[model samples]
Target: MKKTLLTFAVVLAIASASNAQTKIPPNIEKLLQKNTCLACHKVDVKLIGPAYKDVAKKKYKPEQIVELIKKPVPSNWPGYIPMAALPNVPADEALTIAKWITTLK
Candidate 1:
């Protein structure tokens, strides 16, 4: 029982550490909230859509990200449900969010 508890504690600590590493900046957090982007995406963990970090791993430029936000391609992410295109998101706000997303990694 003691061994099991110790292992659990170690796993919890590692999870916390990883979560801590994905802190979102206040400005970006505001934009995400305002645009309802947080409903589907998170900085590190997957929600309804891919995590921002995972998107960053794709190395898409900010402009490309903005385009994706406005017109998402379902084929880009297999297995996950297709992201709805956010054509209503203002271009400037989308670009701001995109620029920040590209810096996640």
Candidate 2:
């Protein structure tokens, strides 16, 4: 528990420092937990949807990424299962999230 707390503390510190550029806010983690976003999309390996690492490989501008996240284009990824839109996710916050996800590598 102590180690967990310390690790979480370190993450919080780094996250806070990088808050302005991060798509997932501290509170968003709670929402994501409830929404189960991680079940399909992971940081590295591809699951049901393309991995965040793969999305980053496309090298989209922040705004373009924001648009993609807002309305996931099924045709763009026809062979794979189409991603559903996440309307609950606000544009500004999603933009931050996309930018941060793209920086995973």
Candidate 3:
């Protein structure tokens, strides 16, 4: 019984830690999925693209982020491959995603 309780506690702790690490609002998550942004980005870890947290650290204005989404600047991220422009994304959607990204720690 004691071993079972300890295992449960450990599982609970890991679940809570995972939840705390990444919590995108449902609306933002919907937008990200719709935009296919999740293909290369994560809330806290680098995927094919830099993590949202790292982008947030740059402290870009929301509008700037929107522009970057439409027209990515390769020089700003030296090691990464140049991000292709996503001009097809609607302005409002891009702004919404950009604002959410800036809120990340």
Candidate 4:
């Protein structure tokens, strides 16, 4: 029974991870590329920064995400290098990306 349960748990974990993959829409992908967000962050996996799904888990409002983009809080993310503030990203684009990020997972 224990072996069966363990196998089931592992399978469930894999399924959940696979399902969490983020699929950015073309517009959102364009915004991400324009802002260079993809350089440090990925939709599903951790790169130089935390994954978008992980950010979604934080439960921040879309506006909050925009604020963070403008003024990154290094303390919020330990171990990873601090994200540089992206003042160049337009407000509309930042909010759009924030909304898309919150939709993940």
User: What does candidate 1's lDDT look like per residue over 1-105, in tens digits?
Assistant: 999999999999998998897788898889899999999998888898999999999999999999999999999999999998899998999999999988887
TM-score of model 2 vs. true structure: 0.63
Ranked candidates, highest TM-score first: 1, 4, 3, 2
Give lDDT per model, in order.
0.91, 0.73, 0.91, 0.92
In model 3, the number of clashes is 0
Residue pairs with backbone atoms closer than 3 Å in model 4 (clashes): none
Encode model 2's per-residue lDDT on 1-105: one tens digit a residue.
999999999999997786445344566565445556677876556889887778888888888877876688888776789887877776767776767766766
State the lDDT at 82 in candidate 3: 84
Off by over 4 Å in 3: 1-20
Q: Which model scores highest in TM-score?
A: 1
lDDT, model 3:
0.91
| Candidate 3 clashing pairs, residues 3+ apart or interchain | none
Model 1 misplaced regions, further than 4 Å: 1-15
Clashing pairs in 1: none
Q: Model 3: what TM-score?
A: 0.81
